[model samples]
Target chain A: MEKQQTDKRAAIMQAAMELIAEQGFHGTPTSQIAQRAGIGVGTIYRYFKDKDALIEVIHENVHGTFISTFTESYDPQLPVRENYLRIFSTLTRLFIANPYEIKFIEQFYNSPYGIAKKRADEIECDKPLFAFFGQGIQQQVVKDLPFEILLGLSLGPVLFLVRDHQNGFVNLNDQLIADIVSASWDAVKR
Target chain B: MEKQQTDKRAAIMQAAMELIAEQGFHGTPTSQIAQRAGIGVGTIYRYFKDKDALIEVIHENVHGTFISTFTESYDPQLPVRENYLRIFSTLTRLFIANPYEIKFIEQFYNSPYGIAKKRADEIECDKPLFAFFGQGIQQQVVKDLPFEILLGLSLGPVLFLVRDHQNGFVNLNDQLIADIVSASWDAVKR
Candidate 1:
């Protein structure tokens, strides 16, 4: 019974993520999510208090996995460029492997829901990554730009590339990821 | 009477852009747009067939202006880096000057409406910019990568930076734009 409950919850999340990613949040509703999940509306309510709660849960799940991949084997003692390349490769791979999740994340982060969540959570979600960039500036290994600009320079291209890869406009092979990461390093390195 | 008609049209466009930028397409209703514009919903129909038509007209107007800025003073014979810097400075300034238009553009581009419009229009919208990048590849001045990847590397950071600027997280001065554009050149230059 517990396993069945868990499976149903997973089904709800999968359906919600896919629908919301393809259609904007306002375009999707809980009834549609339940329909897509092959579950009853009551079942969805049992899993989540409301549509906003469900979306928040989805964001938490997706963002947690993403941040962990970024922080995997992270060592501040490592060269900033090296650390950046490592984070880049893993996060890129994660994004490639999970298009729906990344798409949902991209949309969410750009939407009001994501903005509110970000403010409430503050920068606590990626403290290590933020500190690593700060350390790079302190050590004079990275350009002395504001943290936000540095973030944009280092991560923006990969995010853009992932979108292209998802749209079938580009294939992100290992060699290409390596080259792109190197270019990202160039964008920030002093 | 004609001038009043023009003002009403402009008001509808402005209100629609702001509402759509802040609220996703589906979240906004024609009635709300009319209310925001201080006009009747029927007035909107006099100007547009429906909500979708209104959005499309807005997109056409905004995109046309944006592309013209990109192509202004553009010289194919100039160095790729020089042309890129010129284009970047102008576009960035335009975006900074008009946050609502850029936000609307960004959101629309990532939405289903944007995707469908892109496919129907193909790449016809930015032929000059596209050809310029192609010329760079042919001349061996730019990295030998897919056009999409090249676009991502060159323009993605600026887009990301603009969001930060909009969020009040970054102040993009002229010097910073120059530095960032230089870094963008580094990302794509061979």
Candidate 2:
């Protein structure tokens, strides 16, 4: 019974993700989400309190999957440069594999809901990804600037290029990917 | 009469920009824009055929402003380092000054409408700004990599940092800005 419940919840979330990713939150209505999920509208409330709650869950799932899947092989004991490249490559692969998630994330980050949460959490939210930056700084391998600046200059290039690629602005060939990794390393490395 | 027309158009565009920036296009309605502009709804039709046309105009205006204002003092005759620094600083300052436009632009680029037009123009979108990269390559001061790769590696950092600052995820400072420009130049410079 518990497994079935979990399955049902995942199904609903998947439906919401696809709908939100395609039509955006404003464009996708609750009834439409219910229809897409092959469930009744009332069933959605059983799993999520409302549309906003559902979206929040989607945010959690998307971010959770990224952290868990991307860092599954991350070993903190590695040298700074290796770990840094690992992180960059993992992110590039993640976005490349799931272009829809990038779109969903962009919408979430720019929306009022996402903005409020991000502002409240960004300064204090030092996830494992950020800890990598800290480790680099301790090893004298990364620039000694503020953490946010470090994040921006190093990871920003990859982030922007991936989004550009997803939007069909630039092609992400292997050579370009290699260059981007090297450039991002130079941006933050001492 | 011409001056009045221009002023009214500007007011409408400004209203639409603020609305679209704050809320995604799907979430913003034309009536709300009309009300915000303090004009009759019919007046919007006089200037714009529809919401899509208005948004296209906004795209053109935003890109035009960035290119024109940022390049106002750009001189190819300057040393490679000097010209590169100038370009970076100018872009940083412009985005910082107009946070609203940046938000609007992010929303625009991510939207379906924006994506369609951007993909169509992106291959041929090389402007004077991109020419700076070409010049650097010619002088052997920049990497000999593909120009698109050069762009992604260099300016992508600034683009990300400024957005982070606007989102309250990062605080921009003179020292940090200096570090960023140096790192970006390092990424591209030979």
Best by lDDT: 1
Task: Write the residue-wise lDDT of candidate 1 on B1-190 in tens digits.
Answer: 9999999999999999998888767667889999999999899989889888889999999988887777775888788889989887777788999899988987788787698676444376457767988999998998888777778887789888888788776899999998888888888888
Lowest summed-lDDT stretch of 10 residues in model 2 chain A? A120-129
lDDT of 2 by residue, A1-190 (tens): 9998898898888888887777777878889988988888899999999889999988877877776776674779999998877777777878878877777877787777788776654544456657878888998999888887777776778887887787666788766777788777877889
Q: Each prediction's Cα lDDT score?
A: 0.84, 0.80
Candidate 1 has an fnat equal to 0.59
lDDT of 1 by residue, A1-190 (tens): 9999999999999999999999868778788999999999899989899988998999999988877776775887788888888888887888899999988987887786687676544376457767988889999998888787788887889888898788776799999998888888888888
TM-score of chain B of each: 0.91, 0.89
Query: In terms of TM-score, which candidate is strongest?
Result: 1
Query: What are the per-model DockQ values?
Result: 0.67, 0.66
